[model samples]
Target: MKKTPSIIAAALVLGAAPAFAGSATPAAPEPVIEQAAPVPFSSPDWTGFYGGAQLGYANIDTSAGGDDDGFIGGLTAGYDFDLGQWVVGGGLDYDFADISIAGGAADLESVFRAKLRGGYKIGNGLLYATGGYALADTNTLGSDDGYFIGAGYEYLINQSFSVGGEVLYHEFDNYNSSGVDVDATTVQVRGTFRF
Candidate 1:
């Protein structure tokens, strides 16, 4: 009886072996890979020293009701600090004017200014406002001290170059020790090189 049972178990094992032998089990699949999108670029760095030149039109008004209009040119130098989206700086500039007022009897000679500027970064450009003290010389009015306020827009051409436009108003009280007042409004275009 024991020999019969042993023979039966052996036959069952031999029969089950061939069914699993011919077919191999499949392997686990690899995980799917996904790529990420790139990020966009932001504004350029504006922390540096800069020097430039400017040319523009000047329109002068006097308390005597005279209007002086002509060309103006200048040089500028400044340092800027970029605090993320805001920029602040101070600059010194000198301008020579060819403006004639009082029917060519009085002409503007030169202007020297020290100014402070604050701006916001907008795309590839900067929009700014400036205020400063001005010292002006005239052919007949001599030299007078004054103040100026202005606004401008500047665009970066590259890492080293920029271009801009500005509008400013200047006022002098009791000019040339005379009872007369002088005011000048200017529209200018500027180019700058950064270092």
Candidate 2:
């Protein structure tokens, strides 16, 4: 009977030894997997007020006379509306033109214009067209009222600045007090500060 009890105790100790040993050297826990964060989508934003300077070439043709070409420099200001991939805006500009009559001492003085602009967004640049009214001064003929049409392309250099180029045509009938017609074309490079 005592031998039987000793054999049972030994069996119990042998079984319990493995269980205690297993507790001391447990299986390694499963590795914690981590998922990467999703990447953010980004695009340029173009909604604000802007002002700039323009410098370019001007060619003026008068119906009663000949053609004259000279330098044009100006300042511009506008506000833009950004609608998805399209942009709409309105602006005003004043220019100092130095064109003179082909064979006379008279010259074109300055120009003031009001325009509406529309553009399509491509990457970080905008391709646009503008049309509006223009008033021009002459050294001999006096002040003339006209209309203008233009097109341009502008690219954002950063968050606060942009650069662009434009070409515009201006037409006037019965210039000043004279019964003469006038047409002028200008090509300009522009730099702008955005807000």
Candidate 1 Cα deviation (angstroms), residue 113: 1.1
**How does candidate 1 score on lDDT?**
0.90
TM-score of each: 0.81, 0.79
Q: What is the lDDT of residue 29 in candidate 2?
A: 95
Task: Choose the strongest candidate by TM-score.
Answer: 1
Clashing pairs in 1: none
Candidates' C-alpha lDDT: 0.90, 0.89
Clashing residue pairs found in predicted model 2: none
Tens digit per residue, CA lDDT, model 2, 43-92 = 47889999999999998888777888999998999999999899999999
lDDT of 1 by residue, 1-195 (tens): 879988999998898887867756665789888887787778998999999999999999888777878999999889989999999999998999868865676789899999999999998899999999999998987889999999999899987999999999999988978888889898999999999
RMSD of each: 6.5, 5.4
Q: Candidate 1 at 55: error in angstroms?
A: 0.7
